[model samples]
Target: MLSVYGVAPSEQLFKGTSEAEFPAFHGRPVGGPVLVDCKVSIVKLGSHALGDQQSWVWKPVTQGYAVALENQPLSSLKNHLRGLRTLKDESGQNRLWPWFDPRYLKLVLRGLDGDDLVRLFGPVTLFAFALENGVELFSQQDGSLQVKVVSKC
Candidate 1:
């Protein structure tokens, strides 16, 4: 699993340390919350305190730079989400493990423009996308409430 930062799905984390807009830690906003998409394979499930897991041998997923395009929001229609529903793959081909929880994350993509997807996302992948300190999400939703997108350390 890999983590990314940015509004557009194609955008990735800052190339170098000096280029990171935020601290790469929780509770920090690097940009305005405009729908950031993260990989579920980057998370460590079945833990009390789930922290980010990165490794030297483990590299982040490559940007599906060639297959990404913004479409209509997934919730725009009733059960429309079920129309092109998917898990794991960037576009419904990638399947996720059972240990992961969709309640903690979201699959509200599709509205995002692009076709490039994560060709090789690891099992530990997870993400904390577009959110504010006080973003309000219903109990039915995963992750924190509205995320605040601001520059972090």
Candidate 2:
């Protein structure tokens, strides 16, 4: 399974590196110029270099600066996430949905059901993130959201 992380710019996970080292792309569409500082980035994970830097990265990820997804090609997963960036509001206006942020993800998950929930999961078979005391894992099973919480030992 391929593991990918959607990292928010505030985390600065790639501050001192060249794009070739981490190979990240913004979540926004490809046709226009956008502010890189304000966009969410999609990056592949599990490299030896990343493992070495885990100490610094882990805390930001746990604090909602990133989200993990598994079992999808990088390009496909990026497209899926980009599509979810904006949502129609109650008044029919498009609003930014910061669903990748775990704090917002918890709230977004609560209000999604049936197709809405399934749509969110899309091609990603598993979603995982860390909370203050545990890691939350989300998977779609039998048309519903199934969550597993692994507490810190």
Candidate 3:
């Protein structure tokens, strides 16, 4: 369901079946790749939100950065996004938006591929269960939407 290596799979990094990929990465000082629990850390950003890839288009609603994202501006968000696409765990590799950033800030994912869905996750958006880590952006203009993150824990 996620990438443990924080980036796309390198042939060197592809240790086993794809089914085992986790959501986070941990590199050993010795060399090569290793997977870590990429589980989403439970955080309440409080009752704050804004327009995202999922709802209200370009507008502000009950919006505020999650506590984890406090003061995290667009540049900070870009830094976080970079981490997702870089795979230091592998012998060698690079790609655009290879992995997912678990902690999201204000910016939206602009050009996610329909197939490479790891690029589409965000603090806002809804793609059904077909998509992972979705946050529905709701507006009075768009009726009601609910957000739910199931804890694999």
Q: Highest TM-score: which candidate?
A: 2
For each candidate, what is the lDDT?
0.23, 0.54, 0.27
- Candidate 3 weakest ten by summed lDDT: 1-10
Clash number for candidate 3? 6
Native-to-model Cα distance after best TM-score fit, residue 64 in candidate 2, in Å: 3.5
> How would you encode candidate 2's per-residue C-alpha lDDT over 1-153 as one tens digit per residue?
555454444444544321112223345532234232253555445532222224324346544333345555666666776776667778998665554556566667667889888888777766666656655667777568887775655
Pick by TM-score: 2 or 3, better one: 2
By summed lDDT, the worst window of 10 consecutive residues in model 1 runs over 61-70
C-alpha TM-scores of all predictions: 0.19, 0.67, 0.23
TM-score, structure 2 vs. true: 0.67
For each of the candidates, the C-alpha root-mean-square deviation to the true structure, in angstroms, is 16.2, 6.6, 16.4
lDDT of predicted model 3: 0.27
Question: Which RMSD does model 2 reach against the true structure?
Answer: 6.6
Clashes by residue pair, model 3 = 3-22, 4-22, 4-24, 24-38, 49-62, 49-63
In candidate 2, which residue ranges exceed 4 Å CA deviation?
A: 14-37, 47-59, 63-71
Q: Residue 131 in candidate 2 has what lDDT?
A: 57
Candidate 2: worst-modelled 10 consecutive residues by lDDT: 16-25
Candidate 1 off by > 4 Å = 1-75, 88-113, 116-133, 136-153
lDDT of 2 at 86: 68
Give per-residue lDDT, candidate 1, residue 104: 24
Who wins the lDDT comparison? 2
